[model samples]
Target: MKLRRRLGIEWTGVALAASLIVCGLIYWNSLSGFDNLLYDRLSEYDRPEAPDDVLIVAIDEDSLATFGQWPWSRSRHAALLNQLADAEPKAIAFDILLSEPGDSEEDMAMANAAAQTDNLLFPLHFVFPGTNGAAFDIKEPIASLKQAAAAIGHVNLLFDRDGVVRRTSLCFKDTANGTSNDEIVWPHLMEQVYRQINGESSAIFRRLGDCQQPLLMPYANRGDFAQVSYAAVANGEIPRAFLKDKTILVGATAQGLGDQHPVPLGDGGTMAGVEIMANLLNDITADRFVMPVSTTMQIALSLIPTWILLIGFWRWRPRTTIFVSVGLVIFILSASAILLSLQIWFAPGAALVGLALVYPVWGWRRLQATSDFMDGELKNYRTETPDIPVLQVPLGPVDLVTEQAEELAHAIKHVRDLRRFITDALTNLPDPMFITDLDGKVKFVNKLAQSGVEDGVQDLALDDMLERFVAPEGLEDVKDYLAIDQELREHDYVDFTSVKDEIFAMRRARILSDEGELRGHIHYLADITEVANAAQEREEVLQLLSHDMRSPQAAILALLDGQDATDENKRIESHARRTLALADNFVGLARIKSSEFSGEEILLSDLVIEANDSLWPLAKQRGIKSTVEDYTEGAFIIGEPSSLYRSFANLIDNAIKYSPDDSDIEIVLRSIDLDKQAFVSVTITDQGNGIAEDMLDQLFERFASNDDDSHGTVKGTGLGLNFVSAVMARHGGSIRAENVREGGARFTVLLPLAPEPEELV
Candidate 1:
């Protein structure tokens, strides 16, 4: 039955997945044209030019300063063009469209002189959406000049929906003559002249030109390219030799002319219309056209990536699928950028937009299906009944049978009420709860229990669920309770290991009927491993206190019994001090355990210094050498000053206590690197009888003794080490004990460094 349901889900997923794949393929087919259009637009926006041997004749602020206001007379433009002609460039194409004739006869003469150059190709303006919705029109005289110049093409620019000029006119319609002519666009007038000089036909326009091709001459948007001022050119300060054969563009470049267009290559501002035309001509002349991606290919590429993402998402968990989807999108965007850099156009915005829409829709559908399935299952459970009968009938007298029947009916109602109560109680419990029948099949599970089940495991059996989610020891205890067919209830906790390797404790109880019939087992898991360990620790400390207190008490008792020498009084006093120190450790432990320790902002360096000072006298008496290594110049920590001092003093005292007479003890206080999180570590290492490797593991454990032959032989209570550990823990720090390689015990206490209040602000 379960296999059939699973098969149904799989079939549904597969069928829907196939539909999405087919839809993606269809969408790809439809998107080709749009993507191609985008590519064409992007190509027009890209800055294309050969890296070297190209000089931009910029019309800059400097040129403006030299030439004064632009729209210089046509005679001056002719002179500038004539000067450039001396260089004998391969081609020269005019970026300026001479839509209007010059102002005077001398200007016309100069324009006619520039136009007479064989290499020059003038720009023609083919205006669209003409005035009063009239038909597109081209300047009549400008078209006539096409016959005189080398070549003439329309200069119509296009901007994106956002009003950014990213596309330039590559081809335009000549509606004036009712004929459509697709003409090649050039970067500048000089390029067209260079091409004509080299005897190259305009047919070479279809291919990208190499470095050896016609030079790209750039015109600064402010008309700065012209070397001599208009006055100088007219006055013959600019040599006629310079204008003899050059291609020159004569157009207005003054700011108020309203002839500027935005280009990404320019610094976030509009370039002069003439300069933009100049850039386009340079791009074409150099054969640096943006590589166009066909419409069909764009759609195909977009759809393929989308389908791959959907299929991967269908197979993986939600979190895993989300990560994979995000990563794939990033990869696609990065690839698009790389292609764009290489002059290959791709539709990044369209593709990303499509995926972004599809993924959320797909995920929502999946979640909806899962939710529907769960709702149906719950409905079925509510309407269904278990096979087990609530009660059995027995033979009896008539009156007794009648009364027994009423009693039985009442009992049935009572049992139903009890079951409802049990269900409600289980639902409200914070801990996870599960009940399995005598046959080891799951009878019911609470909400928390369902949550505990791993993702993707919908239906689970009792044994399998236990083995997978519950700890091994807990599972064994559960099985034992089921096998005995008896009620097993206990406050004892068993550690359950989760899939993440974290341990949790489960407290279990087996449910049974009043007649001693096995019904099912109920388990409540409480994650109290930390708390359990703390309780066990407290018990051990109490035992250690008893043993440590006995030694001092025995010495005092002996002194009272007159069993000492002439130094009895002094010996008794020393013993009393040792006892008082032991007692103090217990008091500190209790204070910390009860949350009574008052913490303050204290300098860790000062505490270390104080600890070293206190231990120096003891070290001298024991004939042990000691050194304090302070690396924390002024680092501070938030902790109880007395508690912290006592903790360090205890460690140092222990080092002095265990070290051989005249042995060296090193106490180092330094800050450890924790990836920008500062921590102060105080290390106390002693050349003493080092702890055994096995004993080191339990060194911080309360009442844990090192003596294998005799338990109480150690002079001090084990509570001292436990108390030290407690104090460190209270300060959000930790202590570890280890045996050094050179035969000594080392104890390192790590504390979090406190920041200054001013720094916090």
Candidate 2:
């Protein structure tokens, strides 16, 4: 595939990958319905040997059948406890929260029986925090029953988002209103009962998310634990041998009387909440708790299906891609189920979603690429192949949905040639071209974008590619273009050197809709190394020839009579002198481009004086007075002495050349303060026609000038002010030219003040 098409595919693949990762992270927090279903299915395959330590004394329907009615009298519970106590059981835990007092005599009967063995445990229910009627009170067994109980722990269960009781809280807080009061914490019932049974204090707990700890309930199936009935115990109809040395959990399981929670193993079926706790306690006995797969690992593994399918679709045939994708998905599910059985869980559904989406998303991406390719093809063929052949899809059944697909296919066929042609064009192009969106993401690249990308590099930003290819000095302009920089956009064209020393002219234009809104930009890079090098060679030839001719021309000029020379002779001498000046300017250009100058602190006045002395003779011939203002001696700056003198001399020469004979030429030096920074300012103004409004902006650009023809100077070398600008840039100074109001052009130069040696010390 061509890179433009590849870019579309890459974008679609990345977007789909990002969405898959985000969803996997979300599932890690609160599992999706599909992920939850997978977990449920995996639970169905669990087959564990039954445990023997814990018993569930359920208040099932049979107990209700035998025990008269629901909410049996407290005396009846007392009778059950009394009978269980006689069996010398290790402990008895109540899942039901017996908060309010029953009949006095009945509560007394239950209390009296519970106080007998001191191995009784009951539940305490606290109001849910942030609820409308949130209560601060902790509901414990009635006073007499509380005294009889060995320990009381909260029976609050933590449910997941979909109302599945997946975890259990190790600790909870009592809140008066909707907020926690005093940050107090209370342990959960199972934990507290276990501590009491083992004679231990608090053990360390790790929380799952905010409050709950993951419950690795050793529960394999609903009937995994031994269950008896409340009525059987209450009536003493069961053998004590079955109950001896067992920890008993008591709660209602008769239809609506008990809390029924949907568990992973229950197959959409409900298990009694008390039986759930029984399994938890059984797991505690066996020291078996499930370890969840890490979220990072889950996220990474979730991308597997996308990677497999996307790579396969791009590299292989459709049938092979589907076969590989489907096979990988099956392998993932099977492995995940096995992991779940081993008490390690992974989200198989997340992988399934990623795999299932690759083909449709890839197809959609192809449709877009086809459309773009066709648009470009029409542009190329508007003068060559304007009449595009449109296929006429036959009118089939009157189903709009089916007809839409047929119409789409017919339309795509119309552009099928365009897609192939553009694909070939981009593939054959000698140079790499890239297109980017407003956000600087590369939307397209040619076949040669990165020929060596197979080894390592991928997902390179446009700037990164430029940095790799372009010279460091040119990288800034490349970045500015990438940023849609307004200043760079003002330039119609840019010429820069690549890191390989190749020359290229880059033309950037905004891609806009007919409505004149920005869509993005197209950057076309045209290599012009040979053309630019040939131009440079021509310039060097002119400079050398000019240098060679200047000596003979000067000899001829020097041989002229200064006082008795004819007007024609004077004019010839003048033209020859201009030629010599142009040659000298070329010499300066070659020198400046190749040399690096080091700076030392020097008085600006010295360079100024040297410049004035050098130009005084030229000024005298024109009868112009080159005046300097009286200034303090503190105008010190740091710069290369030669470059500084040359820069100032160029300014004075311009002033002398532009002004008429007998004109006053002036240079002023003073101190200025800005933003608490001290700077020395130099002002040079020529009493000539002030700078043109248009020329002021680009006055410092090489070969840029207001003078169209070479009028006074030799070919208007316009390299003068540009050299001055480069000098200032190197020295961390600034220069600006403005049209003076008094019929002259004013140039101001500012250099930051340097502290004296004494001050530095």
lDDT of each structure? Answer: 0.61, 0.72
Q: Which candidate is the best by lDDT?
A: 2
Off by over 4 Å in 1: 1-72, 85-90, 101-104, 131-134, 140-148, 175-198, 201-204, 207-253, 385-761
Candidate 1 local accuracy as lDDT? 0.61
**For candidate 2, which ten residues in a row score worst on lDDT?**
708-717
Each candidate's number of clashing pairs is 34, 0
Kindly provide the TM-score of model 1 when superposed on the true structure, using C-alpha atoms. 0.41
Candidate 2 has a TM-score of 0.47
